[model samples]
Target: MASHVVDDTALAGFRTGLAGDAITPGDAAYDEARTLFNAMIDRRPAVIAQCETARDVAEAIRFGRENGLEIAVRGGGHGVAGTALNDGGLVIDLRRMRAATVDPRARTVRVGGGATMSRLDRATEPYGLATTGGRVSTTGVGGFVLGGGAGWLDRKFGPACDNLLSVELVTADGDTVRASEDENPELFWALHGGGGNFGVATSFTLRLHPLPVVTAALLLWPPDMGLDVVRAYRDFLEAAPDEVGGGVIYMTAPPEEFVPEDMVGKLACGVLVTYAGEMQEMRDVAEPVLGLDPDAEMATECSYADLQCMFDDPPGYRNYWSAEYLGSFPDPAVERFCARAADLIVPSPSQHVLFPQGGAVARGPAEYPIPWRRAPWVVHPFGLWEDPADDDRGRRWAREARADVEPWSMGAVYLNFIGREGEDRLVAGFGPDNHRRLAEVKARYDPENVFHLNHNIAPARGRAG
Candidate 1:
């Protein structure tokens, strides 16, 4: 696509109407505005509209359309595919709109689209309330929730979309609209997992749950014990209750007080158990895996908000990530998953993970576009490294991890857990039937496919724009 030349006079006029600043390529903050979570993505948008309100979002959309610029919506900017940016186009930067308000009595939170999991969690923590949020603190609530959110609390409260109450959106045609169960019912249904296809979500109203006590346990073993550890974890989760969450991860052990000195910066297999209850209750429920006699262990009760930030993946590193949902985690599959850990770049932040998917996730609203929720396990290879030369190795490791478990593949995937794979994977993200229905809704709100940077759902044919 040819980059449009934005006229100075027109840009000035666009800036006059917006409640936010219009930053161009030469602006002092332009570089910082375009940077994303993955260091590999380096795109330069023609204009970056740092929206402060819903009105600013609407005006930015209108200006981008008028200027014939490809528009990309920026939230927390954590997407591995880097859909939040476009080369020489327009970026609707929502980072400035990070405001979260809690209604303790109603058990809901009204969060600005730019708000991160940190903002939302901290806002509700005082009231002892929270919703299912991304594992890390920096993930944008908008993209995470819209793409079918999963986190430590997901097993207890269900995926983030299950708790979604409503959204305030700015469509491709510069119109502001609200979607909820009682408002725009079809649009509301599409928002469950449609991502940014229909519009830019300026704000979200999410149903929160009362969570007073939370416990986290991290047990580590040498890489050689991965097979036994994984098998034990898989069996333990098979009968685990909804209050139990977390996954098995093979990573380079960090230099922490709880980690053995020799294990630091070495490949280690760890089981992370997050319980939606007190420490004693967690210990009672997690006795199965805890009996393995780990080399290092850290078990404690912490606030939900603090737990969210404990595993924050550092930003400046290059990343490559992929996932495959499995029908079952058999012994052979376990062996394959454990064997692939050797290929991971050691002494780095890369992680080979097996997250349990049952309890609330398997029992969530079945009608949503999320098709991977029913799978029993998800094998995610989260690759993070500092050297640019290791990019190819990083990509290969992640791809091979998914390939190893393809035998038990459920043929479905979660969009948030992966980058742009292909059309088949895109369709798999939302099952075929849900894809068609989402396309129809896309036709109604975004017939032009202006918000096509995400895991795009094309507008249905024969529909008016």
Candidate 2:
């Protein structure tokens, strides 16, 4: 990890690390091992240290520090801009560290930072328990919580960061500390929405709730109904119950049995709504949304776990994401959003989704330094594709789609949804108080900035930076 020009001997030391496998630039498995979810990011790191335990992470950090090499910590390998895997750096991969332990009675669960949303959901759903998380099943715990996770249950519980009770992290100086409300309270606060600027989180103790059952619908509608659908969505969000969640997605129709054959490749909108509460209440709250469009797939109730995997993206497809906070939906701004969808027309018909953000998410732990504290809704534009050649179009559309809504946005973006745009936006993620606090905590735990590849926030008096 020295100057993007590492030699064989240097990578050899990392290859022999304990409890996991390592991949170098020339190894047969390098291509499969190093790639992340977002194809837009293409950095070639000198070494990939796939770590299985916290000790492995500590060792990699120390090794990189002593050898004067750049370091990157990869958990789920889904970083949009690929911050999880840095070029020419020693990557501390934690994919093998996934382990989840649940205590149903106590309503708490301890999960590895390497775990994905689906992994966590499966482990907890049997006990009828759930946690705040992103809508997509493959989203990683590390990035989502560090940046303030938003999900359907956020209205009832809180952001994924808010549900975080504690974290076990390996600091830059190789110190393993448990951060909670009382134990290293400062570090705990910083980790609330600090991204991975301070350290590599090994495991997290999270709060959970009863997810008794789910009543949901993926209402598909015509392309021209985009404006009407957006207006209807705003009204629903304005007064929707805390138990109700999910977002309205405007995308191009796919050629599938569920979709109308005649509408393939045409722009369309679908409200993928979900609610977990008394069945009657869920139906009452969702009825208005169902009436927005002329035709729908029909509303039905199902198991919570079934709902969790509803929007799964194939493992190998490329994904690009961007999000922004809307101040408010005054006088049918939903219609405006629909108008844009109708105009530019996203690159792929199957890749766009927008959802509201206020609800319980707005009320983060009073002291937490989360961005977008009070936005009514945050719009996320995703570009998904299978054809490798369509990569440029996906990237171009994702950026341009976000840009189209710049006027309505509050200049605030979700950290998890952000790419490798740099640290300025990381600062924007958690305003100055949280950012400054995170920097101080980073100084105390990782003065040299060993964990610098993430949405990094350097220590107050860090290395020459």
Candidate 3:
């Protein structure tokens, strides 16, 4: 860890050049600025530079490098690993830079790096245009898109990176640059799934698709019925259209109007089916799962922006999440998946999820570094709880869930879904060949590895620094 005591004179000079405020240890908002989504992460940075523009980002980078301070970038502060903050370093906080510009006629939207999914979705909602966004509305668009975004609409619109038009970035040398197909083409390709290894993205322009409304159905049954329900769901999705998207989740049933009195605060199997079309069409297509006689049901047609916020997980919980992509989901796998649901902590927000992935996601450009996109099924164990004593239990359940389905493992996992597993898993996220190519790009843009907090890719050897 790079540690250098910042003097009062130098600190004052750095703050004067920024368009935003610089928070220190004694500042009133320092504690709130360092807080992240996962309560387990309690890092206190030496300085938090709340940037308001690309110039501010560049200035912060230069200041950190000159002062021998390790730099970390903060977008939505939702990363499970909490790499967005360091113990005694500089944090380039982009939370204040959130701004979105919609060009409906061109079918594109330019969003600031600090912008959340809610800002982007709502900006395009009135125009009846939207792109693939994070499942949670509060998720940061920059991190989500750069980490290969997946959502309910990905089956029809493809991953968020596929819709990327261009990015405005500030490199390690404090030099501003633009990357697209026609400009800095190699850097643009690396941005697809390479994460923040190369530079700090100030803004992104993404292509939008025409989407008027969507129908979402949340059907629930007792925990014992998961095996049969999952089998039926797998069969239904095998023949379903690309417009249909959803997943099977085993979670603690909430006390909603539709939930049965006995099911609340207990383990229950729920199936969500989101249709890109109308309610009547969704009814016709989802007949198989809809006929399963669920004990609780909620189906309605609403705006796409509204559906994004429907299942937003509350923050301030100790979170530990992992994923395993499977090439096939056989009968034995179904049994194992259901058996693990019993181990989940009851009356908590943890979810044992099975998501389908073979639509526009599979057909999208295969050259991107996202190797997990081809897997037909993904087993994600998302653990969220309120008690510190349950940390070991929460982590064990997520790890055991992945161990249960390792037989059908695709060997490639989404980098965003899991924390720092290992170098082998990091290489698996981007294939062996893509990793090599990304290293070369990293050597060109950030040879010193200034942005090493993410699932880092080292600079290629024997390259100019």
Per-candidate Cα lDDT values, in order, are: 0.94, 0.76, 0.94
Which candidate do you rate higher for lDDT, 1 or 2? 1
* lDDT tens per residue, model 2, 1-465: 355565567556765766777777778989877878766567787777878889888888877776777988887777777778777777788877778899999999898978888778888888989988777688787778877787767877888888899999998887799999989898888888888887889999999998877877777888677777777887887888677788878776666666677666777678877887656777677888876654546466766666767776656666767777788765545655666565434445345667776667776666778768678787777766767777776667667766766678776667877676656677777887777877888888777777777777878874332
Candidate 1 lDDT score relative to the true structure: 0.94
What value does the lDDT take at residue 105 in candidate 1?
92
lDDT of 3 at 391: 98
Whichever of 2 and 3 has more TM-score, that candidate is 3
323 in model 1: Cα distance from truth in Å?
Answer: 0.4
> What is candidate 3's CA lDDT for residue 318?
95
What does each candidate score in C-alpha RMSD?
A: 0.8, 2.7, 0.8
Backbone clash total, candidate 3: 0
lDDT of 3: 0.94
